[model samples]
Target: MIYCCNDHVELALDVIVDEYETFPVLRKLKEEEKMSTACEYCRKEAEYMVEN
Candidate 1:
């Protein structure tokens, strides 16, 4: 889910991808954490992703 910096709700995007795994290029933001895209709350680009 994507969230902005001003709101706590998940932000929606119109991204069309052939596969979900190919979208939102995941990258290491820290030693134990990573971020994908920006938030829809306040335009604060940085998300804490939880992979299961």
Candidate 2:
């Protein structure tokens, strides 16, 4: 899965599709489940999880 911020969500989606050759699932992080993980493409805190 790729963790990304709003600004990079599109890039994350493209990566998932190019690598997996299938549609990706995008999920927003719940407030109670927020983590310290940074965006896969940038230094901002991740707000969503992108996966197959």
Candidate 3:
């Protein structure tokens, strides 16, 4: 629902990229398209508890 700060977003991307070890499946999806799958998982993982 928000385009957060770039640093924050990048940090998030970093952690996901680090663990996933590649471009995430979310990157390919539109925000809405992503909602059902990748976005939710990311939200649950990084956005919810850990910022990265």
Q: lDDT tens digits, residues 1-52, model 3?
A: 2222322455656676787677633233345643443233334322221222
Give the TM-score ranking, best first: 2, 3, 1
Model 1: colliding residue pairs: 3-39, 3-40, 4-39, 4-40, 4-41, 5-42, 6-41, 6-42, 7-41
Best by TM-score: 2
Residues 1-52 of candidate 2: C-alpha lDDT, one tens digit per residue: 9999999999999999999999999999987545677887887889999999
- Candidate 3, RMSD to the unseen true structure: 8.4
For each candidate, the alpha-carbon lDDT, in order, equals 0.37, 0.91, 0.40
Per-residue error for 41 in candidate 2, Å, reads: 1.1
Give the Cα-based TM-score of candidate 1 against the true structure: 0.25
TM-score of each: 0.25, 0.88, 0.34
Q: CA lDDT of 5 in candidate 3?
A: 32
| Segments in model 2 whose C-alpha atoms lie over 4 Å from true places | none
* Collision pairs in model 3: none
